[model samples]
Target: MPRRLFIPIIFLTMLSACGGTPASSPSEVASPASTESQLEALATTSLLADIAQHVAGERVHIESILPVGADPHSYQYTPQDVAKVADAKLLILFDDTSYETFLEPLLLTAGGDTEFVFAGAGVGKRADLDLGGFDPHLWLDPNNIIRCVENIREGLTHLDPTGAAVFKSNADAYVAELQSLDAWIVEQVNQIPAERRLLVTNHESLGYFAERYGFTIVGSVLESFSSGASPSAQQMAALIDQIKSSGAPAIFLDAGDNPALAQQIADEMGIRVVADLHLESLTDGAPAGTYIDLMKYNVTQIVTALK
Candidate 1:
């Protein structure tokens, strides 16, 4: 081989040694090992599912029984959902009977060895609402979510002792995030004057939210805790009178509920009606995608509407 041929061969060898491959972008990079191989958990709602995912991290696969915008208070469980629950190794549910009215019977009849972890564990009743029981919207308050995270962490650790450290670390980090979110929410709420911190929601969904924050529950359209119930003519008339006297700026409706009732009330009082606030379930691609995002989105909507 001549000198020119030898030099070309050397260059080809160097190119081959380097593989001549383009580097993978961040999106194209292989993800770390998924915890799908580990125990799978089923959460009753999307909000609870988000909390469980944050606590369990990649150590446990968390699935939500409710769809993106389904009303857990009125959602009927399908046979597929029952199968999902029965196949799960853990079940995370809110302990309120009114909210998750369908979960208890389904769990009992499903006949699975699924370990239970209640998000509303140790959480007491809501003194603000007359729903005949506890408020299941405890996740609205991030502090309550801290308790939920701890309960979920304990359950996950008990299920997989070897993953305790992972669960603890994730829970600690997530709790810190929740604390920061709580402080931010307080600051956001403070922007509105004390007199303007009045809220009128679709139902009793925001009892815990108003209690945690400084808002006053002026009235709800349904007067009941669950969205499945209907408001009587007398209740509607009374709520209209309350809104007219309270001078509340907006009627906040659940993202999943029909806003016709709220619209009717708002039309009567000439007040604004905000229907994008996610209360029970997280949105699929909406601004309120995660638990924290949902809170921030609601806060922004409230502050904007009231301030």
Candidate 2:
């Protein structure tokens, strides 16, 4: 089928999956007439906001606290950010507080009455990468994202019961898309030989992705799970040695991070620094504007660097 014709057919299938109800396209959802009646939601990061927006399906106005491409681990909250939290009827967050250090104080100050949900509540941590707690980058794996979808669906429904059916329908369609994404990722990763599936990143962000996709994480520049932590000279030296021995092709760096250290290591080691990965946040526009696009872009970058 032609691309133009295929698009509507996919949506029609989604509508059929929604029990034949005319599913409201995301853009078709009407905005609230007034601030008092608006169903406002806040997500801690852009990635979380994208996921929430899927289930919200025009029912809730979702805003992300972190700006586009900002580092979530070390983001500084402003007075205006606190106000955003206060204004939101619901706040959705990733479960790991360590990764979002600013949220603790911000929540104490302004989140007393605002209802919130943790999308990573029941997801298991990768044993090899557990620093002090579970790896909070669970969204890296589509399986974990499915759990996030469930939590988000329940949370949105709980906040606005009238939109429960819409939320469910939206989630079902999104989850199906995610399932296809997972399979696509598997086929893409298979392009790289099994022996070459070694990963070395700026931080331990890819633990869940590595575990889910059968890639071996050789080491990370920063040993900590959160990007806020600085690595000692010894740790950096040791990581360089690991890279040399493991023969990993590239050092995947989050676009939101400083990248100075990763670049330094890459320069010293004569390895490529694949700094295009959209780990902590999504892009401002096309290529990686959506969660699925972000994942596909990252996977393609990883494969191109390693394959």
Candidate 3:
């Protein structure tokens, strides 16, 4: 139906000739380092870690509690993750709890003093994008990520007030980048004709993307938003019919997601399955490595498949 969808790191080791002892740069000396080491922040999900890193910059190294490329919808928390939660001074999680299967276990084991930041706490979600509950994949829309940056800025400021200015500067720069990414997505999506902008995903997480980018989500392979869910035969038949009728050319599966189900559905319609779409988590260092990269990669693939 109707939809709206919608980084850089530099480390310079400065050298000072003070009896071979290096002095801190003015920028670094200005921001207090006291709290950073004393209060470490960790992002519980892979996507949160990526976005949080952009906002955090050098203020704090945001560790990922969840492994890279893991599906948060069905991720199981390890004992090491519990220890990380216990030690973390602040934990960043997406406000949309429905999308994070690891949240409950993470919280139950978290220290009482551990601060929490909902990265997309203040962003608005479209009513059309609600799948069962609100779509937890808010990061799919670049505009929503603007608000995520803001939330992260504020949360980091709270965590280490001494780094407020640093956080603001990083967040502002990243917000501008996100705006550019949004514009780029619009430009790239234009390659697809409106009639051709139909999406059939492995999960129902693309609602925000479809609404923002003027595409229709024909439906997902899983009727639910979680990849862990299994579709009933009836549900599968309905989705197959929907995709066939909608003329959706391919089934979009997230990178590293099991494509057997989507492959089965696509086989029914004689359509292709577009695997390697990175919507859930970042990859090691290429293609969906960063949030921006993930969006660009997914958009390019979707446009290519649909156009």
**Whole-structure CA lDDT of model 2:** 0.80
Which ten contiguous residues of candidate 1 have the minimum total lDDT? 4-13
Tens digits of lDDT, candidate 1, 39-58 = 67888888889989998888
Error of 2 at 236 (Å): 1.9
lDDT by residue for model 2 (1-307), tens = 1111111100101112322232234543454445345587899999899998998988898899998888887888998887676555677887746667788777655543566677776777554333545466888998899988998888898789989999999999999999999999999999999989999987799989998899999888788777867889999888889999989888998876678998898998888898778988999997789899999999999999898
Q: lDDT for model 3, please.
A: 0.77
TM-score of 2: 0.85
Record all residue pairs in model 1 with backbone atoms less than 3 Å apart, i.e. clashing: none
Pairing residues by index, what is the TM-score of model 3?
0.85
> What local lDDT does model 2 show for residue 254?
83
TM-score of each: 0.85, 0.85, 0.85
Q: Predictions ranked by lDDT, top down?
A: 2, 1, 3
> How would you encode candidate 3's per-residue C-alpha lDDT over 8-65 as one tens digit per residue?
1111122122122222357655676743454468887777788888888876889988
Model 3 stretches with alpha carbons more than 4 Å out: 1-39, 126-131
lDDT of each: 0.78, 0.80, 0.77
